[model samples]
Target: MTKINVETLTYTQLAKVFDHAILKPEQTTKDVEQGCKLAIKYDAKSVCVKPCDVKQAADILKGSSVLVGTVISFPHGNSPTTAKVAEALQAVEDGAIELDVVINIGHLKSGLYDECQKELEAIIKTCKAKRSDVIFKIIFENAYLSKDEIVQACKIAEAAGAEFVKTSTGFASSGATYDDIELMRASVSDHIQVKASGGIKSLDQVITFLQKGATRCGSSSTDKILEEFKQKNSA
Candidate 1:
């Protein structure tokens, strides 16, 4: 049987798994600030904003324990490796401590595994060599991949030195599923973490993923999830 020890986790422990969202292009500076405030209030590990708002999010999160994160080749993973590398570097310069980069889904689908692996390796190398402390999560956009493909991608991600292998971009057809999370956990070694993102809206879903071995949850519903968790535990 699967056992969950939610009571053993402090509020901060639950909060640190969140990667708050700031993905919309229309999101203003005020929006980013508000998101940062929510992340801090909930003690989230990071606030994930669009690349343009990385600096603003980082500024708002300053002095707080929250780390700033941003997406690269977001929503779509078709950008060249060089462009993604440049974007990741710029985000780091803008004070981002974590990067969630979308892997080239098309290449993976076409069986260009070498190219896909090389793309991730390039980004990992750049991030580690330039900013050793920064964390890199490779988003496989799992909704588009098969079960075998997911396992293969996890292997590639682990071999390429990515810190995490994540699910969807939330713009895809589907989001994180239990099957996908389990597949990722079973495929990668303990050294690599797993992030279950996309379509997570409730505390139950958050706990479900964490219990299944996901180290992080990416969602815009961070505040709502945390509120539900507190309410449930308090009652």
Candidate 2:
């Protein structure tokens, strides 16, 4: 599909940009099934599920356009590179079409930039070799990083062949912000899309991020956000 202006998008168009999130620790298998149902109802781009729940989501959304996605080394990203890779491959085997793996935050904060870059490259290299069509989105968990750190992280992700550079894991102390989205957009080339996750619950926030160059957003309030967009159109 051709790229259109996210700023001037209609409600239906906006709905397609969301990756409906069901990653909360307390969410159950039934909750994931319900989330997949909602993603299909809203025409969402994908349903973000836990790694273990990939097969379940894939089975539920098999005939729908909504893709199955899962996180690896999530929220903290402290897992070793090999562990992350293994988790990613297992997710693919379980039927995940997209993988959002967190970057090693500790490595970045400790100035092990090379280590950080290598971790990403290792995952990207193997995942691509295994499944070339899989979407590899690298999450930075940016609330803990300075502007410079965020920039370096984006650079590393882009260099390592990430399809998108994400702002937060939504499990952090803070989430996506307008400034962070803009900075991330400016930091990377056009080929590397931006995904704003964590606390993006309002329609205005979603529009603001899209207008600022975010290609997609992660939201738990998927139905509410699209309903808000609908209300905006009718208003």
Candidate 3:
């Protein structure tokens, strides 16, 4: 959990909790560039770009504190394990410092636990072998999962060596809800932090998630959120 207190949170500290979302499929090169500039301007923790945008985002964030990140297997994680690893290898080579991957929810729900665990292990082992410092987050896409399923997923994530367990892909039927965030936090061990994603738009929403034990958020509204943080903290 982050040590930042709500009452004393600064815009800078708030910025560090954000993985500025640049994941829209419609985003052009110019859009990614603008997003990268925004991350740099706010000193955001990272620019969570599309896989194809990793190189560009990395170049833009080069020499800055902001990390360059991209999604693996993306909103739907139906790809074969080998395919995901190959995609991740290229993204890391393109300079991604972090990778958020969607687990094979179908496999998990189908009770194919061994297959799911093997896939996660392969992906994590492959990525870490190449980039030891890279932060790997597993997205549970919690909208489709029951509370017990969420806990099982978190356990799988920890056993497979993930650094964080995330909720939602935003492309889902619903986004990050407070109850889901709290439940995820309560279920995971301290070694595995929680990230609340999908539809996290405002400062109050971000703060609410943080108070519930999320360490980071993925958002397209980085500017609006931080500006509000600045104002509220100063007020």
On lDDT, the leading prediction is 2
Better of 2 and 3 by lDDT: 2
Cα lDDT of model 2 by residue, 1-235, tens digit: 2344434687667888999999999999999999999999999999889998999999999999999999999879999988999999999989998999899998898999888888899998898888988998899998899999999999999988899999999988999988999899999998889999999888878877888889899999999988877776777
Report the Cα lDDT for candidate 1.
0.89
Single out the weakest 10-residue window by summed lDDT for candidate 1.
Answer: 1-10
**What is the alpha-carbon lDDT of model 3 when measured against the actual structure?**
0.89
State candidate 2's TM-score: 0.96
1-235: candidate 3 lDDT, tens digit per residue: 4454658686777889999998889999999999999999999999899999998998888899999999999898899999999999999999997899999999888878778778989988988899899888999899899888888888888888889999988899998888888888888787789999999888888988888899899999999988877777778
Cα lDDT, model 2, residue 15: 82
Q: Count of backbone clashes for each model?
A: 0, 0, 0
Q: What is candidate 2's CA lDDT for residue 173?
A: 94
Give me candidate 3's TM-score against the actual structure: 0.96
lDDT at 121 for candidate 3? 90
In order of appearance, the predictions have TM-scores of 0.96, 0.96, 0.96
Candidate 2's displacement at residue 113, Å, is 1.1
| Backbone clashes (count) for model 3 | 0
